[model samples]
Target: MAYYKEQFVFDDGKPIPIIIRNYMASDLEGMIELQAKCFPPPFPTDLWWNEKQLQNHVSLFPEGAICVEVEGEIVGSMTGLQVQFDPKNPMHTWEEITDNGYIWNHDPNGNTLYVVDICTSPLYRKLKLGQQMMQAMYQTVVALKLERLVGGGRMPGYHRFADEMTVEQYVQAVVKGDIHDPVVTFLLRCGRMPLALIENYLEDEESHNYALLMEWKNPFHR
Candidate 1:
């Protein structure tokens, strides 16, 4: 996995102990269960029904994707695609490999790295596991030398799959309606500002039918 260090272990050394590692083919069932708990409108492996996507996920960001285990049992996992957007090299960004089933891709600038999806078992919430996974994601994106990123929160308007809500609803959800989700706050506290709302971007009847288009510069650029 270009996004993560293969065989890397994350040990907070707590009571249950956490083991983060590359996912295996046999772990699909476990992955499915975790997804249902993590995401509200969980796809649960039935919608995509593509084993190859998971395979590619493990391969793309070996260290980026993590299967959490406590007492030798797979309790949860987190994985997402890293679409490198090298603004200076448009062709390379377009040449990047992505499973045909995956809808994400790196934009031309290569400054952006989009997180297509992320999940962790509900039981693991409040353990900072989600933040940890996000940190790994930030590191992976920065490692690729990206200068920007784009993503959105979930919504209720669409009530579909991933696109389940309006852009504002998703943002409010992401921030817990507190005006500051750790992710958004962290990014902004470091010096980034959001840009726009991509209106009517999808035609899916079940989709929130819209997405937000936000970007950030190299806040820490020296």
Candidate 2:
């Protein structure tokens, strides 16, 4: 597949070129750097992508691994894999679903595209690079004739309200627009609907180890 490009203009009207494309072996280092910048110290540094995991992504499903580049630097990325997803049994940990980020369990014939991870450089947050990367994944869904795009979205804002409400209540408040969660809200805005609540989805203290199981069904899938 060919790389996609767009230009974003800054406040001074200087347009910077951005390229969104499938992941390449050479981009692994930059992707790792981006993970550090996006996740920071409190987040486990070990969870960052390593050369082996990135190599697995590119080799196993290159189309599902995408990155955004600005002037030849990797700024944002999204990785996913085809999985045999059972909507009725949607309770799975991030590691279990993503095979500990190696995607070794990728099922070519599976009907669902499971988004494993997505991140953008801290400095490039204003560029909406995440949304663009997601849009590219949506395109992948249609092209692959998948049923939907699914992901376990971290509820980073939940810890702040954990004492005030149950996780379910917190999710309801966010869905009802009564509260705003940086991660969940962003996923909702990307056209994904809440499927369920997953507890102990990962080691995210900010999210109280909780996540919102979200999905975006492909409208073109018949």
| Total backbone collisions for each predicted model | 14, 0
Q: Please tell me which predicted candidate would have the highest lDDT against the true structure.
A: 2
Candidate 2 — which residues are off by over 4 angstroms? 1-3, 7-14
Instruction: Indicate which candidate wins on TM-score.
Output: 2
Worst 10 residues of 2 by lDDT: 2-11
- Supply candidate 1's per-residue lDDT for 86: 41
TM-score for each candidate, following the candidate numbering: 0.58, 0.94
Q: Model 1: runs farther than 4 Å from truth?
A: 1-16, 24-26, 39-45, 60-64, 84-109, 157-193, 201-207, 214-222
* lDDT for predicted candidate 1 compared with the true structure: 0.50
In angstroms, how far off is 69's CA in candidate 1?
3.1
lDDT of 1 by residue, 1-222 (tens): 333332333446544456666677677767666655655564434554256666655555454456666566666565545555543433211113334425345233444665555555666655655555555556655665666654542223334324554446656565453443434454444333555544554333433445443444445544
The Cα RMSD of model 1 versus the native structure comes to: 7.0
Candidate 2 local lDDT, 80-184, one digit each (tens): 999989899999999999999999999999999999999999888887888889999999999899999999999989889999899999999999999999999
